[model samples]
Target: MASIGPNEIFFLLQGLKWTVALTLIGFIGGGVFGLLVALARTADHKLARRITAGYIAVFQGTPLLMQLFVVYYGVALIGLDIDAWLAVAIAFTLHASAFLGEIWRGGIQAVPKGQTEAAKALGLHYPSIMKDVILPQAFKIALPATIGFLVQLIKGTSLAAIVGFVELSRAGQIVSNQTFRPLTVFALVGLIYFLICWPLSLWGARQEARLQTASR
Candidate 1:
């Protein structure tokens, strides 16, 4: 036991704040970017769709850890300050955008063709058709998956610690380094993650159930 105390627990708990904050930053930033990607992918322009597809493929194809490393060290190589928070935020946003864009694209396509035809008959343009006719119904289908993605995003924040972000997992590492108790520290950290994610999983399931009922 290497001097574990209330202060140490407090330190770890404080790091939890960073973890939650970083998760939100990634979620919101990625969510907006993802919506754009999804829209672009579904656009009429073949070249635009292809370019967006390539962007998604590259990000989704690579490991997120490598992306994190690139963000951390790549910016440093260019003589930018590139703080841990900004680096982690940008990396996770790009990562989340790829996955979320795909999720949302699936939802948009899942909408019935009849719906688009009906909207077109109502004199709606593509943007208005998507906004007024498609997105509303599609969002119902999207809710469960989006919530599930949020859980993944939260868990993914643990990776931020790898780049010295001092979030939850890093807090555990610091504690483990001092106490030499990786199992206990990491186990507690895992439990904390579970506490955050399990409820989200349940909520997503419930959302899916309700949507199914409504659609039927």
Candidate 2:
């Protein structure tokens, strides 16, 4: 068996860049769409709430890998010339948006009912209430959960490999096949993922603590 060498390490590092890029793309796209979903879920209109709830249920109830597969192939079947990277980015954005929407919806609901009442008393309409009074507090409540989900999103990018994206996990598989050292290659992969995720976890924890302290 060949030993894991600098070349193998370098290839994995290259894959890491794609993984990070996918994560950022998914998170930014998802966050924007999720905010809209959250607002729809929290709206007074029953039709909007029902539609958003169904969307969330479909995404959250399914596996992300299957979502990627469907998106990759379905687009092709429909005559779109999308690549694996684009498919993965699209699938991950939808998945992240669902979970993030639910998290933010919870945060929005967690705000005191009286706050909404007071905003209404001041003649603030739905948009004004949400923008000026509700969203600010809900954002603080959502920050920890948002960051926590972000770390999960990073790890989830590994699923992109199944759709032929060749991200970090896929890179480990490639190096392992070449070097015939699956254990060493995967251990390094795990370490790299840990290195990426641990700080986000810690930051989420720190934010949670700070928010709690401020609330108290």
Q: Highest lDDT, which number? A: 2
**lDDT by residue for model 1 over 52-147, one digit each (tens)?**
899899888998888999999999989998788899999999998888888888889999999999989988999899988888877778989999
lDDT of 2: 0.93
Error of 1 at 23 (Å): 0.6
Clashing pairs in 2: none
Question: Candidate 2, which segments miss by more than 4 Å at Cα?
Answer: none
lDDT of 2 by residue, 1-216 (tens): 998888988999999999999999899899899999999999889999999999999999899988998999999998999988889999989998999899999999989999999999999998999999999999899999999999999999998998889999999999999989999999999999999999999999999999999889
- RMSD to native, candidate 1: 1.6
**C-alpha TM-score for every candidate:** 0.93, 0.94
Which residue pairs of candidate 1 clash? none
> Alpha-carbon error at 41 in model 2, in Å?
0.1
Backbone collisions counted per model: 0, 0
State how far residue 166 of model 2 sits from its true place (Å).
0.9
